[model samples]
Target: MFWNGSTQATIQMSTTTPLLWAAFRGAVGDQLPVILALISAGADANAVTRAGDSNALMLAVQSGSEVLVRALVEHGAEVDRAADEVTPLMLAARIGAARIVGSLLELGAAPAVRIGKYTAAEYAWHGGHDQLAELLEVCAGAPSRYDQSS
Candidate 1:
């Protein structure tokens, strides 16, 4: 995906069942209880689809649920997993979930990590997600200071 700076970030991402279940929670809007049940039943929080890209995080962002985002993160989803050059944050931005973006950023989601080679900023801009582009830009803009060693 590439950022084009509008509000329609284009992406090359994907997902499945366990990921589907997670995404469903967001689709229905506020179904954490069900998600929690699935998790308890052995849903692989980290399970990626056939291409190994797009996990539960992708769904959470797509669904725009901060509660679900936190639940997934707390459940041990890989905050940094990538799919076809698309990261969770990238997907979240594509969907225009500002809250999800902020939450992911706070969780340490990489701001500079690229989908293949394109950064989230590039994808956000390309996808026309101005707000997302801005958020990703800020999250990835700095070196986090801690990352720059003396």
Candidate 2:
């Protein structure tokens, strides 16, 4: 039981059930109805993996589903929850998910949060998403390290 010492073991176990698995998979597949049903059924919007990382919001970002992202956020997902130093916003920026990025920002995701040596803007820049980088920079209210002219 990797979750032995965690206070959320019950919730964690509940998340491991087939129903929750379906919810997670549906979220990844951008199936809004499945996610809606699971959430309405009392599924933990913030439920992490067995390792206690990567929630539905993070997965929704990876899936590039702005709808799912909005649903998760509405269900009380932490917009800034970091998974391996990368927040959902960072992941969205890296993938050039402008809609998702905007949704996260509107939900109060911090633009200045750093993942190691880079902010979300830096990650977007490194990923060759100039527009996303610029968007993140504007949200951060700070200039990006990479020259926009280049």
Candidate 3:
């Protein structure tokens, strides 16, 4: 915990559950409203998986739940916060969730970041997102050393 002398602050160690991770997985099975309610019930929106592998935002993005993504963003989930390996924008790109990808982009999600040996752009390309790849190129016009190097 850290106190700036005016308030309390603490970090939630990476200790998320299977159900919790699944709930954010590709937004595949998670009931958005239910999960949001869970947050109300003390669920950590930024929690990491049991494997310490991903956060709620990543799950929602990969799951392509733009609605949930927006909700998490609105609730203060960091757009670039990552678990050990995956990231929300990476997940969204991997799943070809364009809207979610765009949402993250608008929220300041980087177009390029290494994820377990692959960049977010690479993830989108491998995930069969030709459009997304093009979008990445467009979004990252005049690739920087990071974009090219990655």
Candidate 4:
């Protein structure tokens, strides 16, 4: 029972069980209703995909859907969990999704989370998002790189 890309069929398919597929579909399609329903039905918000080992929250973040990201977080998604070294906050910052970054921070995502040797703020800076870098720095309780007050 492959997801026919329809919300109804996607929800009805028993094959999308274990909640991982449902979460991935809901996030990829930006379907808040489906996401909420799956979560309410005991879907593991942190369930990782076999392909890239990414969870629903990571998918939502990568989709650039702030609403979906927030919804997943509210549903108990692990904010700091990383997929291949990239945390949700890092992904958001790399994409320059300021709203998603803010939401993750508000949900207790640690801005200090490092992917390899770089932190989320560092990733934002590298991505040319000065404001986002600053925001992450502040959230991590670190001084902004833009600050020359040293």
Residue 68 error for model 1, in Å?
Answer: 1.1
Candidate 3 positional error at 133, Å: 1.0
- What are the RMSDs of all candidates, in order? 8.3, 6.6, 10.7, 5.0
lDDT of 1 by residue, 33-135 (tens): 8778878898877766554555676767776788888888888888878766678877776666678778988888988886566777667777887767866
Decoy 4 TM-score against native:
0.78
> What are the lDDT scores of the predictions, listed in order?
0.69, 0.77, 0.69, 0.78
Give Cα distance to truth, residue 44, candidate 3, Å.
2.0
Q: Which stretches of candidate 1 lie over 4 Å from their true place?
A: 1-19, 25-29, 50-53, 142-150
TM-score, model 2 to reference: 0.77
* Position 8, candidate 3: lDDT: 17
Name model 3 segments beyond 4 Å from true.
1-22, 25-30, 115-117, 142-150
How much is the lDDT of residue 40 in candidate 4? 85
> Quick one: RMSD of model 3?
10.7
What lDDT, from 0 to 1, does candidate 3 have? 0.69
Q: What is the TM-score of each candidate against the true structure?
A: 0.72, 0.77, 0.68, 0.78
In the predicted model 2, the residue pairs found to clash are: none
- Candidate 2 steric clashes: 0
Candidate 2 regions exceeding 4 Å error are 1-30, 145-150
lDDT of 1 at 89: 79
44-97: candidate 2 lDDT, tens digit per residue: 877676665666787778766788888888877788988777898988888888
